[model samples]
Target: MPVPAPTLAAPGESTTPVLAAATDVTKSFGRAKALNGLSLSINAGEAVGLLGPNGAGKSTLISLLCGLRRPDAGSVEMFGRNPLDPKSRLQLGITPQATSVPQTLKLRETVDFVAAHYPEPTPTAELLVRFGLADMADKQCGALSGGQQRRLLVALALVGRPRLVVLDEPTTGLDVDARETLWQQLRDYRSQGGTLLITSHYLEEIQALASRVVVVDRGTVIADGSVDDIRSHVAISKVTLEARCRRRPSTLGRTRSARPLRAPERPPWSPRTPTRRCAGWSATASNSAASKSTPPPSRKPSWHSPAIRKPPRP
Candidate 1:
């Protein structure tokens, strides 16, 4: 269930400065609506997680915040100015969901190129080492593995030392160790008062880095609250049962029988069994064991899956 919206501040009321905001925004592409009256705000020094299932408006909102696209209605602001204004974006950094660098450029060159855009960028050597790409600095971008490229993309985003960092699925292709490393770096960034707006499919990732969460679904803001609040609304209940028997039951042979056992008339040892049976109880047991031993069918590669054939438009 969606949580109630927070109370609004009255005009002239002092409040935390908003670093980024999208007010009653609506955007459409062709006949598809990507965002519909979605409103969100990021205050200074916040770590906000934007989450939803595939085709949600998470990416569309990020693009608007970064000035890559404009809203068809309403407004998007960054640092109290239009996001398209160069001054407003000077303190901004972004890592999009799908990224590609010039394949011909070497890793070190790529980092240097991006760093040159900012007035006070992190040293290229330091940035490369920090992301564990020091050894691969001389390799061409094309030669790097998917995980390496992902790491490089994140490293470039931070090279500018921007006050606000927006990341879209930043750890998509990363392994467990690499993902943990990135998370630690982000935590440190937040410690230094850097505001962050991140979207990721991994719920645990959001729980680890974000204090607040904003859920988008069907091109609208469905829920917005602290992590605890969101968890309370969506938390699942689980029950576990454990039973013990003194010894193997003598009626093991009747396990596959179709007969139903009435609790009042039958001993607990002779529990109800399946309505269907194999040739014999022993044979059924053997078949079940064999099935357990068999390996599961191999899954097709992600690219072959229809669900992920292309990055979701939303």
Candidate 2:
């Protein structure tokens, strides 16, 4: 039997779903395998994480989800409607990779700007305060701090009062607090029955906020399930630490990688460490790597710092 998800029964449309359903979606950019065959199902009130590594074709998936591009093969449907249809556009929220909100526009202007897209949007005041941007409401999105920009983008996503929201690296440059704040916001959105398809690199973010995670590698759906279930598929480790004036990483909790037994090199699998520490430290497998093929990470975190103090659970 094909993977089964809810399908709405309506006249002239025996094949439609309340959320989204794609089958054998494939896209190719020359020789690069952008999407071999990817499929995902998102339901109302659900928060599903879309995960992958560099060149994993995640951006392509987002583009297809938003109706920005046509797949070379397969089908996509949203809420008993097609994404490319103008009618379905308003029912969805999208935060793309491009520095989404325009500059020159004050934060308030941006909010109001997006509000214009809908006949009735949520109150601007509520979105501003919910994202801790009341003070910066008059500032241009271009001038706002990275975290602030991300927050405002999220606010825009909530404007349409959409039934489905797709966030691409939503917390891309946010501080731990800001990221955690958004995490809570997502949970609240889920509680209100808004569905979400989130693409992120933060493993813990998916673990904490996503109801289910679908791991994609090279355009293929390699793994999909709850956090525990996915984590159990790969060999990884966890390390704990307190606030530190000075810290060092330890070998105690480093991962026991199944050498050469690659598992997509996907999310929930951070790189290995060199040595150890007590006051403050993390663990991981360590080996010299020099492929000269892949570029360095966009951001390099300091291990000598404090643990990302997550907001107390809701």
Candidate 3:
């Protein structure tokens, strides 16, 4: 069935212009539904982050917003027109999750090709230099490293100086320095009034770049708000104490028994602190055999871990 157009802005909402929107959109592939009544909006001059776990419908939603795929139900709009309309996409740019480029074309030629499509494209020289691709302008696309190719893809997205840009995992394979460079460039882009919709597995990346975060799960939005608001709503409270103790102190084992401890390193050593109890807590040596055999609990944070350990409020 044909979907109806979305209203310009919801009642009692901020009047900022909405550059793109998905209204109660749904999509399905065979028996697996990718989206279920999911709705989102991107306002002008805003940097929004889309976050979700694998198979949470984020990619499907992006496809709908970019006109790469039509939704099974509901509507998607870009610049107040149907996204499938070519005219509506002229001011939009996108970097898909998978990266590919013409193997036979030199980096410069590729940039020139994409720029030619826009009436007022950004200068090729400036785009290359800003993305650190100037030195490799003559290199063929096939000869570029994965990181370089990723950077080139991003640079191409901006070649047209788009009003709205959508990036998916923009820094996936980049090292720390290169990641920082891209972050700074994105910040500068937002400062200049360009709107952004970014999806990244890196929570820190989202925190660093987006003023608003949208979290999706079960094919729908579960949370949406500012970074701090999201954090405060879903974050787990963690408290740590620094104490020097020789060997695995009985008190330390008791503390671990009281509550889980996610320590990264072995506890420090000090003979006098074996039974040490800090000011706020009490530590008593237990003679129970189970206490003697208790091991210190430890965990290390990794990129693959959940963005927030605590469960979301109902």
Q: Positional deviation of 296 in candidate 3, in angstroms?
A: 13
Ranking 1 against 2 by lDDT, winner: 1
lDDT of each: 0.68, 0.64, 0.69
Evaluate residue 195 in candidate 2 and report its C-alpha lDDT on the 0 to 100 scale: 77
Residue pairs clashing, model 3: 245-269, 245-270, 246-270
For 233-290, candidate 1 gives per-residue lDDT tens digits of: 4421100001112144344333323443331132344333211110111121122212
122: Cα error in model 2, Å:
0.4
Instruction: Estimate TM-scores for all models.
Output: 0.71, 0.71, 0.74
Output the better candidate (1/3) by lDDT.
3
Arrange candidates, best lDDT first. 3, 1, 2
Task: For candidate 3, write residues 1-314 as lDDT tens digits.
Answer: 11111222332264678899999998999999999999988888777888766677888999898899999899999999998998888888888889888999999999999999888999999999998999999999999998899899988888889999999888887776777677777777777778888997555667777777787776898778765555543422112232332244764454444333332222333222212211111110011111232212321121122222332123
TM-score of 3: 0.74
Best by TM-score: 3
Q: Give the poorly placed runs of model 3, Cα more than 4 Å off.
A: 1-12, 236-314
Candidate 2 regions off by >4 Å? 1-18, 236-314
